[model samples]
Target: MITQVQVKGLMFDPYNNAYIVILRDDEQSEMLPIWVGKSEASSISLALENVAPPRPMTHDFMKSYLDAFDAKVISVVITDLNENTYFAKIHLTYVDSEYTVDARPSDAIALALRSHAPIFASESVIRKQSSEELDQWLENLKPEDFGKLDS
Candidate 1:
């Protein structure tokens, strides 16, 4: 089982780097935050804000490539989590065949936004890997708090 989710926002963790929170679309109260590299965070931020760059970024190039090949990104799936890392896959369809490729959840999400693809979290991953305390903390967080980060 997979639950649909939406990008909640990009956040900065003062002690760490930046992270983007995703929330269950059906149950807005359920959420997860994945820490991402600065570059990836920027990419995700640009997309989330609908900022069109002068040229195509890596993910934008991917969207063009998919379009050129008549392939559509069906959805992105948050597949698993191990140790402290989370994993994801991008599902694509072309002609009569479908394919899935491994991707960082953040990049997958960036592409999903460009392609208008939905996002999903595998039930197993959520059941076993999600942190309730962290979720609660994020839920209570305000955007102003993210601006206080030294980064």
Candidate 2:
């Protein structure tokens, strides 16, 4: 079983090149945070803020590929977490054929946002990785905390 989840927030850890991304369950009862690379973080942030850069970013290019082929993203699934690593897949329907491709959760999410696709997590992964409740103070987090994440 899979549960639908949505991007809740993006947090930055300045000490490392790591950016933390939060995912909220459909019921808003849980949050799953995953560490991602700086560039990926910036990409997700751009979509969330609806910021259009002067040029297309990598994820934007991916959306263009989808548009050109008439392929639509059905959903993105965060499927596994092992030894501090996360795994994900993008589900697409192209010309009546369905395809699932391996992707990092951050990249999957960035593309999902571009495609208006719903995000999901495998029930087992959610049960293993999500916090019972989201951090109450996350709303106060500022983009400045993200540092030079676009790099």
Candidate 3:
């Protein structure tokens, strides 16, 4: 089973040289972190800050393209964790056909937020990582948490 979540915040992971996507569920008081690339982090930050890009970024273009086809991103599922890697799928619905696309958790999450789609994580992944780890990681972050990524 997959549990729906929300992006609680974004933080840098010095060990991985990448960003961490934080997902939270207040009802259950749980949190999960998935490491993501710099580019994907930038895309998510831009959307969170409501920054208007001079040109449509890849994710924006994707949203527009999907909209044109009347396709809606239903949800994003972080389905697996293997050898320290996280996997995800974007569930899309278009007319009569439902499409599932394999994607990195980072990219899937950024697009999901833009498309107003709920984020999900497989029970296995959550069990492997544990919410306590997330709590500790979040507690250690400071105000100057995520610095700007170099373009």
Candidate 4:
């Protein structure tokens, strides 16, 4: 089973020296935190802020390629978590056919945001992320800890 989710916010993990993109369900109840590199976080943050760079970024280029081919991003699904890594798929429709492309969760999410595609996460992935360490980290987050896009 998969549950639809949205990009809730972006935060910094000082300990890991990485940025985290938080995906939240409609009720804002369930959340999945995926740690990503600074560059990836910047790409996603720009999309979330609706800011278009003077030059197209990698994700923008991908979207443009799909647009040129008249393809549409149907959705992006966070499908699995293994070895402390998360996996995702980008579902697309083109020329009356559909295709699923394997992608990193961060990249898939950035494209989804740019393409106006919905995001989802498999139940098993969610369950796998429900670790006590994650719980503690989440509980420790303050309101100001999020939206650290520029930093």
Clashing pairs in 4: none
Model 4, span 1-151: residue lDDT tens: 9999989889887755678898888887777889788888989999999999999999999999999999999999999987667889999999999999999998999999999999999999988776455789678965565444222
lDDT of 1 by residue, 107-142 (tens): 888899888889998887777645687756667866
Candidate 4 similarity to native, TM-score:
0.87
Winner on TM-score (2 vs 4): 4
- TM for every model, in the order presented, reads 0.82, 0.85, 0.83, 0.87
Which parts of model 4 are misplaced by more than 4 Å? 131-133, 137-151
- Off-target runs (Cα >4 Å) in candidate 1 are 129-131, 135-151
Tell me the alpha-carbon RMSD of every candidate. 5.2, 5.3, 5.0, 5.2
Whole-model lDDT, model 1: 0.78
Q: Each prediction's Cα lDDT score?
A: 0.78, 0.84, 0.81, 0.87
By TM-score, how accurate is candidate 1? 0.82
Which candidate order results from sorting by lDDT in descending order?
A: 4, 2, 3, 1
User: Model 1: which residue pairs collide?
Assistant: none
Clash pairs, candidate 2, are none
